[model samples]
Target: MASFATRHIARGTTIRASDCGSLADRGSSLKVEALLGATDQQLRTSGIDYTITAPSFFMQNFISFFTDDYKSGTIYQPVGEEKIGWVDVRDIAAVNAEVLLNPGRYKGRELTITGGESLSYTEAIAIMNERLGATTQFVSITDEAAVEAVSAAQFPEFIIDVMISLNHSIRQGHAEKTTNTVQEVTGRPPITFRQFVDDHRTTWL
Candidate 1:
């Protein structure tokens, strides 16, 4: 029997056997969440062995979203002091590879992949500053301003709303939990944010 493994952005909450039911409930308000919930439902009933890898925030966001601001010596975000478990995409891929190679071992499993540590943006930026020897600062912006900034960037209205909702969820402390799914699945510890920064130090410079 062939097995399939799929990855989805879990926003903040980790998906376990117990949390699958809530995906549909959360989908009621968010379009992206609803689509993911529907996909999960289909996979569960497909009768084919499937594994879902639900991952938290990606640590690469600093490279994509905060790089320009970091270059300016400041990074602004709407999540004030909320800590997030930011997983490396490479680690997520490792878990996916492991499940794909040994499908029977992980059948019907929903693994929540996350970083080894939970850190707020401020705390993370501090780590970056120390690691890269840069003095970039983290500034918290209001939700309204965040929306305006994205809107100004001409992001689609639907995407802007979804991002705002996800930020709200993070602000409520939904993404703060760390998981050992990476180590459990891949036999290696997930990359830490500090190490991620150190590895990508040239990007900031």
Candidate 2:
């Protein structure tokens, strides 16, 4: 485990995974901290610097994990009417690169990064349908059914539980907030969800 290995690390900065602000944020953060807490503590004990990055749901999820469902113009989830601050992964990388290159500058900092706009799945799919000219749909499901569906695939219980909690959090409006950390840290506006969809139109086509 990466967490266990943190104990052996004598120097160098660490980047911890945190969550965007929302109702569904706390449960996952606790689970992540359990895995990474040892590393966090070890880094502190050794006087090594560390920073945490809290990013919202990634814009690339549709292309990466949900392509099969997207092919049928469907984005299935339990996220109800809540707007999500969908983040572009590229900007996450840029911030990480900046921190990695100049670790001392961002020492002990925890940044909540986002793509700068919040939109529900319905709005996002509409944008995709318009720009990509593909009639993508956001098909919301009940929390129990979504969890059961993932569980039926033989996923681990913990993974399924987390997925359910994440969806519940979104439905509760936890991930609806946006932040300027990306622009502030990288000195440029974070890519919008539309930009990400436009840039990757060929993937869906």
Candidate 3:
């Protein structure tokens, strides 16, 4: 699906494809990750000017995936004590905009963007608890349990599988690396999880 769209979009104009930072190592065996890697390969060999903005785990997951869990005072996930460089979607968007505005400058370059810091779920929840004045806990669950939880929430099977695989990667410390790509590209530091929690305090409140 993504590769098909990219093939058509790369015909005339410059193209920018969003991908996962895991592609940096070229070691991911996950289904979605492999698919993205293949698409990136196509873009690189197509002889077209393209920019790939590969971002780490999104910070907005707190609002979208973990909101209900946070409301219940627990963040349940398969990732144990592993730290992840959770980049804000807004920062990723800024990078995309910068690349789009200066296509020639970033031609054929792939930028892996991440937050300024890598933090475990426990550390992130601590920040949120301190900022939002709420007591939220991080509970490590088995991959099977995580899948069951998402399934009970009515998430599609593919998404549930992807979530579990990503969590597994995080456990292996694949998402723990931080980079200056966000600041280097946008002329500003990537938003920290602390700042993100502060800005979205109302979501938890």
List the candidates ranked by TM-score, beginning with the highest.
3, 1, 2
Model 3: worst 10 consecutive residues (lDDT sum): 9-18
lDDT of model 1, residue 47: 65
> What would the TM-score be for candidate 2 when compared with the true structure?
0.80
Worst 10 residues of 1 by lDDT: 16-25
After superposing candidate 2 on the true structure, give the runs of residues whose Cα lies further than 4 Å from its correct spot: 1-47
Candidate 1 segments whose C-alpha is farther than 4 A from its true place: 1-31
lDDT of 2 by residue, 1-205 (tens): 3553331221222222334362212223544333444554555556555666667788998788777777786888888878888889899888888877777778777676777889998998888888878877888888788877888899999887666656665666667788888888899999988889889989888
TM-score, structure 1 vs. true: 0.85
The total number of steric clashes, by the backbone 3 Å criterion, in model 1 comes to: 0
lDDT of 1 by residue, 1-205 (tens): 9996754222223322223322222344545555566777776777666777788889999998889999999898898998888899889888888877787788767788889998999999999989888899888899999999999999999899878777766776667778888999988999999889888999999
Q: Model 3 reaches what TM-score against the true structure?
A: 0.86
Better of 1 and 3 by TM-score: 3
Best by TM-score: 3
Put down candidate 3 lDDT per residue, 98-132, tens digits, no spaces: 88778878876767778999899999999999888
User: TM-scores of the models, in the given order?
Assistant: 0.85, 0.80, 0.86
Compared with the true structure, the alpha-carbon lDDT of candidate 1 equals 0.77
